[model samples]
Target: MKSFIFRQFEIRQSAEVFRVGTDGVLLGALADIRNARKVLEVGTGTGVISLMLAQRNPNAAFLGLEINQEAVQLTRLNFVNSPFHSRLKNIHQDFKSFSTQEKFDAIVTNPPYFEVSGSGKDKIARQTIELNFRELISKSSEFISEQGVFSVIIPAEAGNEFIKTAEEYHLFLIRKINIKGIENSKVKRLVLEFSLTGKALDESEFIIEKSPRQYSDQYLELTKAFHVFKG
Candidate 1:
């Protein structure tokens, strides 16, 4: 069985359609959920983000949505085995087709951003053929409450496109954290938070490694509270 043991939870990864990774962990741990009553995670592969958020905010209730049925089942099992089991739920559905009367106070996602090859060589990459940057922005704008926060992590170039699309939908950027794999490497990923109104942006940068296999203090500190594999 492929599994990852964390400080507060253990994720069974074998059945997950999407494996837990740094992007999901970072987006989950760094999201703004201070006053959230209801939190939603879109494309919650193994429910890692929802579990992290649940641990961070004991008062909040969480729901995780996934398009893959196997992923939803795995997420349910993970949530049921978690300490916050009573406060978490998982749904088998695509974000675009999900119809919910209730709006979330905080929404977090590490959406699929890989481009499908035009040659149609990779069936896995084509799973998100229906999803795009604009779809994510538009749906997030509609599903979140007025005072809610929406957080996401994606590649730097995709993040730029996402930000521009979000602006069109009036989801203004509130916080942005750019991440580099190594100290001198180019920015590779972005963790961003958005809300309805314009505000002074909280911008920051983080480098994951000082050298090969050596973790940076900032990266370690950011994830140490939950992750056991600091190296």
Candidate 2:
């Protein structure tokens, strides 16, 4: 199991269960919460992204929806043990069946990534829950407020699909950052945000490692506010 230990919370992730990864951190850190007053997080696996946003945006009220009972219970436990526990609400509900009954200033997700048929150690964690790429874009668009931002981290292939899907739903790309392990490695992930305009999308790329073992200064800096590691 790989775990994330914070001053107030900890996420214990397993290959069997949906584990947290660098993509979640990248999405959380780069997500634009500057003007967002209220936020919604879909498929709150282990509640990692919600906690990250809670730390970064102190004033924002974060609502998270999760389907896994075990994960929901674990998230609740982690929250109750945290200093900012009171600021979070972890709902045990399927995002597909959930209706917030109100719009949100923002919505973020590190959704399931596996296909109906694929070989993987973490199949559940890597695939979509019930919402496919198109359904996610369409359903999420209905919940977003005017000019609200929607952020997510998906596989590199899904990134382009999401852009095309968002285009159909009228959600425009705002910013995107591609992530790689090393200079010569293939781009594996994309951290992105969308708004209501198709005009002027900010595109960027990031490398997590600069060499064989050292972390890139950019990677360290972006996560410095949360990770205890500083160099």
Candidate 3:
């Protein structure tokens, strides 16, 4: 399970504490990366979203920040072997203590879900990149350029809480896509975009699987370019 393959890129894990998952895929697909010039990703586990962003926007250069040493090594490797490898630059640092004299046109992230308790695998590794809701929003707001978008994938129950938190920073809500495990399943995650502007915009939901062993066409389309399992 340490090595995972996507249609566009192959990920090296094991040294990777967090392997690629549905949340990262949903954020990569649902993000609006069309006109982005610069982008940033916090807690960039395996650099999955960074790789996805690079695939989506070949012209956009990305800065992916991660704190895990093993993930840092693997993300760097992933970027090296990826299609848009040159488009990315990764840093081994924490989002809180790390700052720049630069601003990004777009930002995307998949933070840790606090819905479950930790197993104490790597104390510093887990807590730092745990993807806390508040820190992510506040930091993105500080780094994003005006009219730019901030995108993230998070647990559905915790997603709304992020909106409320961002409102405090004047980072308005833009669009959202909710992710479900299956057609009739409960909402599992939210893929959202935020900006300095807010308008009543279109939002939708996606069901990943039509059946246990069968992934839906829509899901395949969104992730087809990324998953090798899909032909």
Tens-digit lDDT string for candidate 2 (54-162): 8888888888887777777777766666667878889888777777588888899887777775576555456665667777788888999887899988888878788
Counting clashing residue pairs in each candidate, in order, gives 0, 5, 6
Error of 1 at 175 (Å): 0.8
Error of 2 at 33 (Å): 0.9
User: Candidate 1 on 49-150: residue-level lDDT in tens?
Assistant: 999999899999998888777778889999999999999999887788878789889989887677765554323323456567788789988889999999
Model 2 CA lDDT for position 223: 82
Q: Poorest 10 consecutive residues of model 3 by lDDT?
A: 122-131
Model 1 residue 227 distance off true place after TM-score fit, in angstroms = 1.7
TM-score of every model?
0.93, 0.91, 0.91
Candidate 1 regions exceeding 4 Å error are: 117-127, 229-231
The number of the candidate with the highest TM-score is 1
lDDT over C-alpha atoms for residue 44 of model 1: 79
lDDT order, best first, reads: 1, 3, 2
Residue pair clashes in candidate 1: none
lDDT of 3 by residue, 170-225 (tens): 89888888788988989988888889888786698888999997998889878777
